[model samples]
Target: MKICAIRAFTPLTAALGLTLLLLSFGPASSSTGWLLAQDEAPMRGDKKVLTIDDYAKWRSVGQTSISPDGRWVTYAYSRREVDDSLFIKEIDGGDPAVVVRGSNPEFSKDSRWVAYYINPPEQEDGGGRGMREAGTMPTDLHA
Candidate 1:
């Protein structure tokens, strides 16, 4: 009787184990089917992976400021191997003003204008290089 019972359960146990193994390695949808909608599945074909070339062309926004009247927004846009710019845009509508090589923008007290620093063009003279290591000061320092 014991041998017969063991023989009867051997095939059933094997089938159950096989089923569990297949479920463990099945598609991700099988596990997350309840959380995701049927129409909201990932569009894998439309996506493109980012590469190193994409990073080089990327632009980023820096510090931002709002006008006193809350009518305008100013922010710095910077990119690699290109001059940075300050963008001043009207809050409600219209095109934004672009200031090349500008940074640290501040709106006027009356909100009539914006003030910012225009960075000097980069020179190949290696200005400010080795200031700490060589203990040399730049002669053209501005207050």
Candidate 2:
């Protein structure tokens, strides 16, 4: 009876060990799914093949902040290697104008004001300057 029990337990233990071994290596095999998808075409009809120049011309928007009333939005827009600019737009529909040469835009709690930090350009003396040091920081807040 003892020998019969040992034979049953041995097969069960081996199967459990094999399952754990396969699970341990699961992530490495599953990561290849992304590689398989890379060769597939995009799901848009009007999409064209992207090139390096297209990336350079790409305008990226970042870190959008909406007003409390939901009527306005402030965000940063930038081109490749170019200066980032802050912009505010009405949600109802209006042209977005550049508020300042800055990023990380924020809106006031009252939804009446927008603010952003102006990053100083590199100085010729290889030093950095703050907004005050650069003189006349342009802010969207009036008052």
In order, the Cα lDDT scores of the candidates are 0.51, 0.49
Q: Which candidate number maximizes TM-score?
A: 1
- lDDT for model 2, please: 0.49
**Between which residue pairs do clashes occur in model 2?**
none
Worst 10 residues of 2 by lDDT: 30-39
TM-score of 2: 0.50
Q: Any idea what lDDT model 1 has?
A: 0.51
* TM-score of every candidate: 0.53, 0.50
Which of the numbered candidates is closest to the native, going by highest lDDT?
1
Model 1 lDDT at residue 141 = 22
Candidate 2, 1-143: lDDT as tens digits:
01111245564446433432332232222212111112223335665454454455445455565565666665665556566667666654555556455665666666666656677755668576556322122233333
